[model samples]
Target chain A: MASNLRSPLARVRGLGSAKDGTGHWWAQRLTALALIPLTLWFVAGVLGHVGADYAEVRAWIGHPVTAGLFLLLIGATFYHAALGVQVVIEDYVHNEWAKLASLLTVKAALLILGLAAALAVLSILFD
Target chain B: MSAQDEAASDPKARRPLSPHLQVYRPQLTSALSIFHRITGIALAVGTLLLVWWLVAAAAGPEAYAAASGFIGSWLGLFLLLGWSAALFYHLANGIRHLVWDAGYGFELPTVYASGWAVVIVTGALTLLAWIVGLVAW
Candidate 1:
């Protein structure tokens, strides 16, 4: 029982503490901080564009500021989501092999989707 | 005792599992904490819809129309409503967490107050968004 106590540093790093203590925790919080403004802007923008046609939506995304903010939103969102789901998996998935596999799979999938989303935004902006 | 000593003395002794959920009475703090994680997962799954909408919009009018058509359906609207609720709840609760991280709001009264605030604020925000969405549409 005494041996089970994690150091403060380990707790700060969250589940996996591979040298850089608090890195994962800080990343999660920082991304969450970033998302606050980005998500609000996105929600408001989407609401503003409700029922809009293709051209209207396309033009919105094509605007330089909109495109830049959206790209930032995409990157931050997917990265934060991956970090979050990773912790959830680590907590509930008891089997070691299954846990590792799921973590890797989530990371890969989010990476691909993030890139795809960025590409979609870029194509719209450029087109 | 040291690991080796314990192992030698009680070879069959193994690590015990932590207490399970059923063992404890549910409380607001615990419930809200669990909900935060649940909504986090929900939002992750909901991201697919966002990605699809973006890709469809980028693809062409035809693709955009298809995506919009589906999203306009009853089931799609229902899911979006739920997703919006989850998003707002997660957002509100996340701010609460940030507040906690700042080393305030740890008092029991404050914790419960913030928990209820999160719930109420989320409901209000979701309703507002949906109303605005419908009006805009």
Candidate 2:
């Protein structure tokens, strides 16, 4: 190797000089992994609604098991999107101020949308 | 006047550090960055479609029928196909990232090879999903 005399720690132990962040990378993947089965279930549930009437749709959501699954899907998906979008802004937005601003904006938007959707689903199933 | 001469300028200020993308030929790392960005945008827009589907389903039969009708259109089908591909690609790539985090694919050749693998696997899965979807219809 080019630096055979150096220890392996020298090559990797303190490489954070760039102030680089890894949480965003890790979180995105984690959430995606979580969403896999949830997403599949969601697609199937929607497919089940193909020709169902309004009451049928309502009744489906009203089922405790379905409502619980739907909520899990919503929460996981929005959280996943928020994490993914944060990384996108970090990679593309070169301007520091603009990057931070855009990141916050995406986070807030996802949070609001995710909560709103969850509430809507809950209200339907509950009342 | 009391300060010493500032003749000793910063030694590292002008020295070259690590090579950047500008210096190297395109590689998988660069390609991964681009792929991540594209997938991120796709996910964002795809979320809107999800929200719309939910709203329509929640609204009532007429609204759900209208939305589903639009979804049945050729344009809707095309978009759905694209979105499904995006979802699968992102999912496969996410697994790649996790593997990478644990430091398995760090070798130069392995990096590129796995990148190609990700692409191939994502396409295969997308096609599989569509095939399954067709059977359902």
Candidate 3:
């Protein structure tokens, strides 16, 4: 032990929480709360159309209200999924570089794929 | 003092972590927690399926047939079944999590009870959805 007599809090004065985890955590929950109802609605809609043909399915999904909610579902789902997976990678992946690469890959895939889905919804709405 | 000790002494060390998941014996609480993450990741991957279905719809009826055909196949049904169950489980367990987040339900009995409730709700909802799917066709 050194002869210095600095207080523990003072010794670590500048070091603090990363401060991002709280936002991530809160957002996860908020998105989750949003998903509860959205998911039920979507699932009910899907279950109702179990064996419907393309035309029938399109008719249901093409409704303005359905499309709007669908967009919200897609947005919330992807953002929530990205945050969740990022935490998983951070937790299990030991190597920093591999962790970083995988994290970026996962985020990118989700973002692009989600955008594609959103565009698909918009196309469905317009066409 | 080796490297770990040196790391311990350094305040600038970004993150020092240990194998937390491995060291603990699996308890019901912990098991439920792990399943939450596992189901979460599964649902995340399932979004690709969602994207494919939507893109197929956007592409038109022929492409949509391919997507629906694949989804209507045995393998697709199996995966959809899994995804649905995972969805239900994750949703129920996630609500439990939010309840905990709100600083309630910390009691051990309540935790275990809620875990079982989530399991029951998942099973029932999944069964109900499938029934509706099959009958509404």
Candidate 4:
């Protein structure tokens, strides 16, 4: 009687379910790795802004290198954050509808923040 | 064993248990998960601060000066302190994740020890950075 039906394990083992989790897991870590240096640079950059007036801050960020790095840091930080929070919400939210809503909300907010930061950096560079 | 006793004696015969988060101890892994959530929230809030700074800078000198002064106050300093800790904690945890990725530190003792170490090191670094910042000022 037990052998009458195909085993669920056999159906799942060779299929995509087991393997696909790794992509999301790997992506989270990959973004984490990229962020370490970028975060360090961003910290130091903020430190440099200490006591700087409007013009001084603007000039520093206006430099092409600083602007470029600022954009990179912002982009990577938000990307990493979105992935991290998505996992947390998925794990804890429990309700299916709530989890889906949270995941979408987080991603949308991340995109908006990233774009806003990018635009801010460009505004400084061009000014 | 009697039928009632037999049912009670067999752990495997029990219905599926409730989820782990509701029942588990506050172990290192759980603590780390909480930390990750907290840091994520802090980072989200801190992004608003970043936007504020940028907007002020873009607006002009007088506006920027007001914003700059506001951020330099004690309240601003306290907020910065929190932001710095979040940054460092997240950074250290990210490195820990990387180490785990290389197939190392999976032993139970090592995982717990490293988790505490990440917390300590992040705190220390954040303090040192703030100290240096003040001294430089």
What DockQ does each listed candidate score?
Answer: 0.78, 0.37, 0.74, 0.57
Candidate 3 residue lDDT tens string, B65-137: 9999999899998999999999999999999999999999999899999999998999999999888887875
Ranking by DockQ: 1, 3, 4, 2
Over 4 Å off, model 1: A1-17, B1-19
Residue range B1-137, candidate 4, lDDT tens digits: 68977875575785555546577778778789678779877887688778777777877788777777777889988898898898899788868878988999999999999999998999899988887788767
How would the candidate models be sorted by lDDT, starting from the highest? 1, 3, 4, 2
Using all chains and alpha carbons, the TM-scores for the candidates as numbered come to 0.89, 0.74, 0.87, 0.80
Q: Which residue pairs come into collision in candidate 1? A: none
Per-residue error for B90 in candidate 2, Å, reads: 0.3
Interface RMSD of 4: 1.7
Better of 1 and 3 by DockQ: 1
Error of 4 at A24 (Å): 2.9
Q: On residues A9-113, what C-alpha lDDT tens digit does candidate 2 reach at each position? A: 554444433344455555666777788788778767765665566678788987889989989888889988887777667766867789989989888888877
Model 2 residue B79 CA deviation (Å) reads 1.4
Q: Runs in model 4 with CA error above 4 Å?
A: A1-15, A18-21, B1-23
Candidate 3 residue spans exceeding 4 A from truth: A1-16, A19-21, B1-5, B8-25
- Residue-level lDDT tens digits of model 3 in A1-127: 3785765555444332544435677788899999999999999888878888988888877889999999999999999999899999988786778999999999999999999999999988888
In candidate 4, which residue pairs get closer than 3 Å at backbone N, Cα or C atoms, i.e. clash? none
Instruction: Sort candidate 4 into its docking category.
Output: medium
Alpha-carbon shift of residue B29 in model 1 (angstroms)? 1.0
Provide C-alpha RMSD values for all models, in order. Answer: 4.2, 7.0, 4.9, 6.6
